[model samples]
Target chain A: MKNNSLPTDVEPAKTDPRIKLITAKIKKENYKPDALIEILHTAQNAYGYLPMNVLKFITKALHLPPSRVYSTVTFYHFFSLKSKGEHTCLVCTGTACYVKGAQLILNEIEKQFSLKPGQVSADNKLGVSVARCIGACGLAPAVVLDEEVHAKVSSEEIVNSINAKIAV
Target chain B: MPKISVTIDDKKLDVDVGKTILEVCKENGIEILTMCHLKGLTDVGACRLCLVEIEGVNKLLSACTTKIAANMIIRTKTEKIKRYQRITSELFFAERNHVCSVCVANGKCDLQKLGYKTEMNHIRYPYLFPECNVDTSHPWYVLDHNRCIMCTRCVRACGEVEGAHNWNVMNRGYQVRIISDFDTPWGESVTCTSCGKCVHACPTGAIWPKAIVQGQLEKKPEIIGELVEKRKMNL
Candidate 1:
């Protein structure tokens, strides 16, 4: 993937394919300023996060004010300004989940990776985060690695699942 | 636009159909507390302060964004509204490190006035104590995230009024921050006109001129509205 429209500030290799995908998405939207959210979603797909240069590129390409774009990005829970790790881990902290030892699981993940919520591991292998609720109360405590839901995850099973999945 | 008759807090008044409930209330001298609202900018409804009860609506709606409809019964001073207002004010204080005792906008802050208006004695919720940044990179201004409630008035004012969209938000939830030109230092921004519109747009001491000290910031937010009004005249 190559983005001919990619901004110069970013490196050529890591940003190229994503910028190409993002550019395609922008073209698909016809570069409408009001389509900021949709474009950001596509950018996340391409780049894993909304990089500063990419955001700047989008603001210019869409002809929207930079502040407006920024405000919208930060206001939404789904948006992220940083890159996700090769493996993404999400722990639900809903009332049900919390009571079922979600906190312990979260703590273990942090301990295992030495990374906090919203932080990627130094090795770039794991990204740790917490969700308010995943609507999986039956699972009590759940961990989502990538799109696959690990329901009813016990505190003891947390580390093993993350390590096994990442190893695969 | 057609005039719609509506009852706001038992007072019947005919207002413009397309105008928002907050605008109607403002025209009729009904004070609805707000923080994210700036007369000159677009309303994002981020702040829930102007929430009012209306007949037939089960949930309270923010007055700043909802348009006035015919025969709508709006209650601005309901017990529910008052309770929520207090909770909202408390949440604003609890969500950040808003230590007003030593703040620059101690006396002039709208958030403080909102606290007083809501009669918020002390916060029941635990303080978030989020480690926030104080950006002094700008030569003339300081961006103190400690006092920020994320009202986004500065974001709107910078974009809609000054036409300099330098200020934007970064992150999510209580971790959100107002970033200048894609999370760069304010002094290093290429788009910042250094207009200081954000300083006036802020309801709290999160943004202030660098030269100002504790309890000394005197912001005139009305000037933004005045400027907008003047622009309409096309001078």
Candidate 2:
């Protein structure tokens, strides 16, 4: 049977600063396997998404199995295996938001940019997604553009905002 | 090991303390419907079919995971449990494409047996019909996502018995999937030993040998528990 362990001496590419950041975080955690989730959080924050190679690095460093690492990464919603693109449009489809035409905003965005929820544009400029709720229910039919909440905005206004950001 | 008294379906009996309600019921020949449960493997209680109502407890607990307690009053065949089991069976059918007529495990599938046991006449909920992939990447086995019930039996069997954690669950909710090593193709899995333990662990046609055809697939899930027992004998 083949050994699944990687040599401790083998390190990830030294040129990438993001790797250095992850290595530092792992070191800070003392390379304890129990801190796997904490280490994953640092890696995700550095790379915006958990890339395969980075995941492999963590697996090797923690002396954990590949499936263990991958399973943990895939379980949580906060972690993303794929990039969320340069600009993101997150529409809230909570009971309150859906009651106030949240689906219409989603439709308008899909019509304008040809991007559906959980889909990224071919150019990788814009990505669209939906949330159950962001707890901003008072702002019914709310849309989030690049981490900034656009409260009570019409579908046309949201589309124009996305166009303005991604066009640049 | 002292025995404890418990009343199950109005039948009072003295059973072992550490044994689960399901284990006690099974030993005593009390019928309790279950899925996602296999002997000799760890009990995860993923399937809610084994739910039994306990006196003073508001919610029904799974028999497989809940241990028997002293002077406990347990009811397994209540009308509420029957209703829930039927609902669960219907949801399992409606969640994916379980076209039994075309399935390889058609007549022998546990899911089909479960439907019969629960008396599932027809599904009321709309079928999700999510486009699932059938991975024929392995040289000897095939992994069909459509037939999967998200039971972690294969995952546990691979990890605990085979000592190869090749199988793992990815994503969540309706989008959950059984992925092989970083969601890559099974044939390309660096960790998989191709032991075929997962084939036996699977309760559905989600994983099966490539050689079999419709209704011809034979699975010996009992071998897994027997294997564990035999290993303890050190023969």
Candidate 3:
């Protein structure tokens, strides 16, 4: 058993191998402007979300204004500044799906979970969002839960599906 | 220029070799409504508003993107085409905060103009006005996430045209938004030149000149096309 094992330093120690590896890579790149996207991608992958210090380090290294880096991240939907849920559900509400009662299916799920689309469930079980079209119009009124797609769904089916997943 | 004949609204016409059906129609005084595909930017083919039926092509092709082929048969203003365009326009209005009366780009906006041309009435679809924020932190421009159509015209203008690469679009599907650098605030983003070209390229009020009065918005005509031509000359 270790006594007084709490870390005194708030920051991760320089001796930590992860930090050293990142620093070595940064040194090798010497921070070109073109590498801004790559660095941000690496930082987000490593740290989950970009912290202020990481952004600052990127700013200095890339010789780019902090605004430029921040804008690129915000402009494209591929990157996330905030930590997202492990599971994301995308429902199709395109014209084809809309005609087939896609809205009702989404409403039913939201009512059952008290979670709006784009909101993570209180238990962090799911994050839901409505997509314009997921290229599955033939499967109209489709509700995609994580990687699985449920088609021709009723309100009851949505509720049961959620309950079943939750029970599991 | 080589000549190619095509039909528009069932009227046959001979057009230049390499021009799109849209360009042919425009030259012959035909009106086709669009929002996303600007003359200057590389055709994105996202809107699907410009879709027309070609005799041989089974799938509807974007008039703006598809170049004219010799003796190509085409049909415009068909019931199918009208329905598709109307639905797409309705979706555009429903997805964003396009409350025209209060919007800065009310009269002058391309989306509004498209709505006018299409005679879009009563969005049959439900609204998805996601709770987006307004960033006035940028000294010269206001970035309203609600009004953005996600056309990426502004993004293209910033990166490809202005060569700033300050703006980008974040997320997939409905959660997507135009992000300045690193998903930070507009003022905080480093790549923004504050050139205001993005504001010009935006078809809606998503990116607008700061405090543009109710009756004061006017779109610059042919600026993007002119700029593209100028750039091509330089290249």
Candidate 4:
């Protein structure tokens, strides 16, 4: 006889170690709904981006509606629903950076890689994004490549750096 | 409830203290324009159409959210307020694809009526023709993001009245959107009860039933307030 019923012993806690970290954080916060943003920060760090299954698990643990959790997650800029690729290039486009040559850098990168802001490459190797400012006005026209900030960069320099990172 | 004396547009009136300026204005037959405010739902003051000039305050305040205080001198009809209202109406038109000629809520839309009320003849700002999606996933309803002004009335009506938190706003700034269950299709939503409260709550043609075509959509937003009042009587 075919066993139509699924196995009851399979648990996400045993398969994924990241779920344990989230569970520990939830417990540390006493499952309080006010701690949702803090818990989401931890979950985003673990998964790189928030997945649907993880959101459902968090919603269930917190006893909140799915829409409430989803709304909070999408309201903030720090959280992301999709993967930001393995390597990221964040260009500053604030008033200071825009006064410098930030747009030129963006144009050069688009010409070289054919990837616009908020777009990932075909192979998922690099993602390009633009931020209003990183509060580094002194370093105008700055580009953050994989968490490392390059200050006062020209279009050619940014292109070279992105090429080096993508090549790796 | 205690009464407070307030002068609105040079008219003296003694009204209830806890009520908002909009409420007091409505009771006194003073015209104050509003779009995001539905009587039953909690006032978010999202739309800036109901701004009124209060004495001693440099900045204009929204009438819907600002409660009436003792001896508060308010001016609902002013040259400055009219200019701001016109600018707001223009911005609303420029922000989205509000082409009323082919819209479902053409003559009946609140935004169109607001434009006429504010004397908005032309839009000064450049139109941002951003690509928007029309989600027809729900069996009975459709959510067209093109005509949305981000008033959030539907979001509040779904959560507060229907008790089904299926609709929510996602993202921020120009990219903000109303999502159904984790940004999935509405038909695939697990939380939505499909009570159609949002359809009636929407002031624009952004949300409508599937059966209705353009220019035939009718909404009864008063039903939300009536339902809330009925619930209070039962309790």
TM-score of each: 0.76, 0.85, 0.66, 0.85
Winning model by DockQ: 2
Give the alpha carbon lDDT tens digit for every residue of B8-89 in model 3: 7778887888888788888898877677777788777778888988888888999888998877888878888898888998
Clash pairs (backbone) in predicted model 2: none
Error of 1 at A107 (Å): 11
The lDDT, on a scale of 0 to 1, for candidate 1 is 0.85
Candidates ranked by DockQ: 2, 4, 1, 3
Q: Rate the local accuracy (lDDT) of all candidates.
A: 0.85, 0.89, 0.76, 0.89
The alpha-carbon deviation from the true structure for residue B98 of candidate 1, after best TM-score superposition, in angstroms, is 1.4
Cα misplacement distance, residue A11 of candidate 4 (Å): 9.8
| Model 4, span B1-235: residue lDDT tens | 7887999999999999799999999988998999999999999898999999999999999999999999999999999999999999999998888899888888999999999999888999999998888899899999989999999999999999998988888878888888877777888889899999999999999999998877678899999999999999999
User: lDDT by residue for model 1 over A37-90, one digit each (tens)?
Assistant: 999999877666777788877887898867678768778867776667878999
Q: Which regions of candidate 3 are displaced past 4 Å?
A: A1-16, A19-168, B233-235
Cα deviation of A150 in candidate 3 (Å)? 25
lDDT score for residue B60 of model 4: 99
Better of 1 and 3 by DockQ: 1
Against the true two-chain complex, what DockQ does each candidate achieve? 0.35, 0.36, 0.19, 0.35
In the predicted model 1, the residue pairs found to clash are none
Model 3 chain B scores worst on lDDT over the 10 consecutive residues at: B213-222
Q: How many backbone clashes can be found in candidate 4?
A: 0
> Candidate 2 overall Cα lDDT vs. reference?
0.89
